[model samples]
Target chain A: MTHDLTTLVPLPVLIPLCAAGLALALHRHPRAQRTISVVALSLMLAASLGLLVAADGGPLVVDVGGWAAPVGINLVADRLAALMLSVSGVVLLCVLLYSLSEGMTESADGLPTPGGEDPIPVAIYHPTYLVLAAGVANAFLSGDLFNLYVGFEILLAASYVLLTLGGTGARIRAGAVYVVVSLLSSILFFVAIALAYAATGTVNLAQLAQRIPEIDPGVALLLELLLLLAFGIKAAIFPLSAWLPDSYPTAPAPVTAVFAGLLTKVGVYAIIRTQTLLFPDSPGVDRVLMVLALLTMVVGILGAVAQDDLKRLLSFTLVSHIGYMIFGVGLASEAGMAAAVFYVAHHITVQTALFLVTGLVERRAGTTSLDHLGGLARVAPGLAVLFFIPAMNLAGIPPLSGFLGKVGLLESGVRDGGTLAWVLVAGSVVTSLLTLYAVVKAWNKAFWQEVPAGVTRDVRLPRGMVGPTTALVAFGVLLTVVAGPLYGYADRAARTSMDGHTYVDAVFPGGSERGRGESPEAGGGDP
Target chain B: MNPEMVPSGVLVVAIGVLFAAGVYLLLERSLTRVLLGFILVGNGANLLMLVAGGRAGGAPIAGITPVDEMSDPLAQAMVLTSIVITLALTAFVLAMAYRSWQLNGHDEVADDVEDRRIARLAARNAPVYRDVDQGEAGTLDEDAAAARDETERDEAGDKTGEAT
Candidate 1:
């Protein structure tokens, strides 16, 4: 049974998927649907924790349905993969709680219907949310590139439904932009997959890790570029990122928070995987990524500075902070990669927490518009405190996890010792300062300023909403308290990601790099 | 694996043409054309995968193969998966376009006001590096700061009209 723990890798996707079907079937019973979804998610969290602990020893590779690797689907949970699962699981569980507490569970139209006549079918939200989780889980654990692409499609499809849940005009408009942009990128991803297979004859990550280096350098670079462009659009990097600020801010709060936190990070995760496992030998790609990272930081914050709406401002900042992770990825060093991984985990919590708090603010106040918001600090002092902690944490305030992650990244950047790297270091510092400025400005407008005469109504927040947000805030604080061990773990995870042998070995097993160089038939090496 | 078995060059030219048309439509603001572009691109990619699978021949049935020179089933499987994905996305995008048409009377993607604002600001904006002493000479520092804040507030006030 203990040996079978690695088998739990697929359980995260499986449990949620099964729950989604069950929940959808029970749509008339909202309470049962919530119970089913929550129970399934809690189970996933536990399994994710188990996977995290088991994976710490080494990569835990489970060939699904007992099929051999390369040909059959495989789920590999190394430290990096496990950490992503655990972190996202935490965020999802918390966001679900927050939405429930906020009474944001909905009918198909995403609004609470009056009486029992047209019942608000909270059932649909649960199933869609579950499917989204399954998709995220699949992406994190997939060993094959095609499987990863499927994971992305699953998540994006769920997200499309989630984004337009309420069917408001704004949401619909946002959904259109989102769908178009997403489709365009996914098509590119398909083309990239096609081209990669054309070049190498296999789409398994481990096999590609071996074979890609053997191809003509130009072809390899072209393949890597196609993959990057595809993932980059999804990640919301600059030049490819204009649609994000327009798209994310219009979704409902919980949807927006989750999208801000998890969705783009999936893209970042893919970029990290490709940079390390598949294209580690390409320094030029790393440099190109670094420059893009710098541009993303500068451009994103500038947009942030110009925004007056809270959600849009946060959306822009979300784009800005992604630069930090990309900066980490481009370093292509163990330390750089570790810091990047650490920063990713840190950003997910802090950004999601901030967005969740914004939701709370919106509930208390009438809106998240900075101009209309003021005097929240004096009125809803508790909400003000909630908003303050995460805002400061986001700004890289000392002793907070955000600061630690940035320092780790900066330390790595300095150690890399190139003019380009230093330029990124300077851009990162500027971006951090500007991020602090933007969020603090938001704090001053939304919390610190005096409330207007007419705006001093009831500010009481429901216990349910406050409880989950407090939990997330506490979780963010816990990252700081456990900074030593967490950073150590990230450092180790980084080292693991940088080394391709562990991944190659975990998936390939006794079959040495035979997936590459040989024919595609050889990789499938059937019974 | 054999050199002679790569897909016909004609397939490559067709894919290129499909990609070119797809990109041209993708750059348009009309949602219908964008959707069309997306479809074309997806088809192009599927065709690329077909070509990538080498020259097509026999069905990849398990055991008792009709011919050993079977098309690469993996690439076929990938294309099938992508086709399903593309179909699903097309339905979703069609709904979005329909909804957009219902609300706005046309299916054009509305330009983001903020994007336009930022672009305009960037175009007209040059570096403003005002020294503290010279710019506000003979004026109270608090007044200068207040002036700056007022300009910010006015700009923010202008933004308040957007209704989020």
Candidate 2:
């Protein structure tokens, strides 16, 4: 059973990659491209769900090319990884559907008339989207540090293409900042990996977990800080986050939605994995993380409060809420990790749903500028409902997944009882209230105010687009409904991760030397 | 760990200088310079990976060299992968820079529009956006009196004037 599941682990990464090639081949046939993308992603989603169930028993590890763990690239679908993959799988599929519908609507509206802003470059969009999905899955499942870096590069590369699609002046401007910043981060991460390999002679994460603690304390801290720095920029934690809001709001809506939803969380996921599995007892670093989390929350939401554009505001809130997950991680407790996991899952769905709704709003009102949007509640009541559920949920209203995730984090924060943790708790509460105020202000301006002059109200939202967005919103609500089992799984995942041996042992059974094709000179294999 | 496998100081110094110059160029506004900086930094990192592999030695082909005399093949393999990735990304950044040049007649990175708008508003001491709930610019008493709808005025208007 475990071996069968191990085979399933690579499918999430493989299927989309293969499909990407096929989709590119069929690009001339947009119909075939759409079919390939949808079918491929749907299959990947199913594989991810299967992995999620199998991972519940224990992590399923696959040494790629049949090489042993330490010598070859491996993919491990552990509980945390499987959960991330499943959530991302769901998000990727929904966004693909939404973008496809958007493309259809654009062409239907008589787009692609010679020189009229080509309709989303349908030929390139499907392929790049699939590659992005593959990259994200690979990142979630990678067991080797270098493989993880490869995954990051894959996703970042795809994102750069998506962000600057159509090469508009605004997009080019934003992409420049985003690309340069991401390149710098990747270099830093590359340096870190090299240094880590120098220090410990291996980059397999499970092996690193064993060796890292044995290295010089200063060297270990250096490696940890370097990794954190790279991930911090990617995750958009306060001082490193200014580029996100500027860059994200310029992209087309579905592209921005997926970037907003999944990309930063991948970084957060990395931090969680590394902190728990590799450096488990670093109180000092955890405290610093706590401080950073507080600053990220306060500063990010404050930025959100000042935004006039709906996408920009949501982007800022996305940055702020990441702090909540960071806070949960910094607490370094099981409950905290569990809450952080749940929060990540909840935030991904809500943030993407809100962005999708913003896309709908833009379609209806001809802009995402809150200052110009008005009377949406009366003009497009369905869009209003779609927007409101996720908006209020994002603000942490009761009985929603967002509220539950926040409550879980706050409870864990109070349980932590340290001074920094208390401050973070207070900071989180303040951020939540400010978030409420900001979204409410936006709600009033965009949905309730009198319709501004010259704004059209008669544009209808395509059912195809609305269907995916509503399904995603419903999925978010279902998270609240099934909070019991999900939180339980998260708690178990946290416990397993917090005890690093479960992971290490999973990779190297009976303590070592179980995988096939182990090279003799690799030192752990038979001499 | 082998005692004789220490890397040369020259390579270390070279890596340092490359990174320093790369980061310096990276801070420049020109996208071309940024791309150049990225290339420099990428090469510097590749060199660092080389240094991490220990002193250079013969290839690890089975009969060509003894295991002890062979350099760490894994690091070399990783460096090769990183180099390819860097090359691909360099091409991408180059294309983007060209696109920027084409679009704006210069490849200099521009400021965020929203940030600039907010800065302008701050300089002028204006509210970010007008809020209807704030009830226009007025003192509390004046605004409250203006907000009131008097029945007497309504009745008089209905009887004698065009209330509609």
Candidate 3:
């Protein structure tokens, strides 16, 4: 049934973007707005799954406005993009459910009251969040550099709204920092795109993949460096990552969770895409990536150890684990890339689930600070269970998907053995163990430790919140249950990425060399 | 393809200066300056696209200018797109600065308490601390004293004592 569902490829992105406007228009009727968003994302998830299935057979490409590749904007749903889209769709759906359950769409307060006085607050969150999802989908599906930039901007603009939902002092403070940092990254990205177009006279990824390798060595290196810098800031690699630990923890829980789970991964995805597709054979560049990977892992985990706040600890670990993916990327091997893809999928699910559980912790205890939070296990075993599963999974506990991902990556790292690879391998293990220690410490303090004298112990456990948490946790476990198949998918996707010619052909069908600007042919250059 | 209306050399120098100034302002504590620096960088990038288009000849307007005679229209489109993006995002940042001022009466992006603590600790870990013992041995050097004074400054700069 999904054999020829290429037509469904663009629907995942197009639906949510159109729904964002529809949702905003119906903001006065939040029920209608909620219905629109839920219906739209549900459709997105379904279509994305279908696309994922179809893309496994082959990549699907579409040119918007009937324009050809190189001239018109294109959307390509290859295996990796399909995996990202489907997984993110599921995550977004769960987050939206959690938000609705938590009354994030209803009141100025995190808590819900029937018919709250403030209309704009409730009205704004749904549309912006959907727009953010749309932007993410657009980025994954976009086949051109300019469209990718547009995708980043779409999500970032939505994120500005999401980050400062309540306009509280700390939220505003953090939101300002996030906006500024993100703006800088986007501007750099814009500059990079311009420079790339100036050099190659084309912004299409497939075409660039063909032309970049043939360009002047100096210009090519400069373009690659510029792109790396832009994406590095976006991905928050070690030296460039300081802004993340500060900006992320201050947003409301679901927003923070979504940002952590999918936003940074988008940057990582772009890195993987550009490095493999555009500048595939840069050996020196791979080494530099390896060094950065090692540093990001060690520094991020050590920072996690020093944190007393659960959210901050998770944020650090988030940065640390990005190193693991980079390790895979740096290996520049099929196995390495496969493992990286698998790890990205696993991390996104587990991280979002952790933050969702953290939100529950906040809702139940009024804080996530380990100093104030204690004995959660005794009062709320269910919340403790919810937190414990994803937390352990995040720490790479055996039999969980996280462990499987780590082992896959380690195996690949060991296979791609060199001095740098070995160092990265050691760094990955250390990061894993430190991650375990940090989460365990949280487990000891927030769950197992004695309840403090004055701290509030029991609170209403809303199913709206708890139910989605359980669902996501179950999904994480399910990844483990299907590890064999999921890893296979990752391996295949990585193989596809390793083979760049397929991507170019899928986009151009009959090679980009044939099209030498008919207009340019009319003007001066060879016809 | 329009004749290289803007000299390539001038644009590269302008972009370099603009990018340098943008990076400088971004490093500062002030949000307004950061915005201005970003604007400069954006204009510089736009100029770069123009230079990338090759020596311009004419506008690549269909049914009019010959293709070979035309300026690179795609490059022009991308620049227009980037300009729009920069304008929108810069406005958003301006709003963010305004909100921050309204909330805290400052446009500075304050370093997180945890980050400051980490920095202070890292600063303390410098090899200069090993010279504290060296000072007792008759070589109370400038490096050691400077390091000590820097630590003292960090201690004074942060009012909240470390808890752990």
TM-score for candidate 1: 0.90
- State the lDDT at B132 in candidate 3: 19
Once model 1 is optimally superposed onto the true structure by TM-score, how far is the C-alpha of residue A5 displaced, in angstroms?
1.5
> How far out, in Å, is residue B150 in model 2?
55
Pairs with backbone N, CA or C atoms under 3 Å apart (clashes), candidate 1: A107-A121, A375-A451
lDDT of each: 0.82, 0.86, 0.81
Prediction-by-prediction clash tally: 2, 0, 13
Candidate 1 residues lying further than 4 Å off, grouped into runs, are A105-121, A511-527, B116-164
* Residue-level lDDT tens digits of model 2 in A1-527: 33555778899999999999999998789999999999999999999999899889888888787777877777888899999999999999999999887883232222212224465577798999999999999999999999999999999999999988777666777899999999999999999999998898889999999999888999999999999999999999989998999899778889999999999999999999999999999999999999999999999998898767788899999999999999999999999999999999999999999999998888888777776789999888898999999999999999898999999999999998988888888999999999999999989999999998888657767898899999999999999999999999999999999988888987886577454354422212110
To one decimal, what is the Cα RMSD in angstroms of model 3 from the true structure?
A: 7.4
Superposed Cα deviation of residue A4, candidate 1 (Å): 1.2
Ranking by lDDT: 2, 1, 3
Best by lDDT: 2
**Superposed model 2: Cα runs more than 4 Å off:** A104-120, A513-527, B118-164
Score residue A256 of candidate 2 by CA lDDT: 92
Return the top candidate by TM-score.
Answer: 2
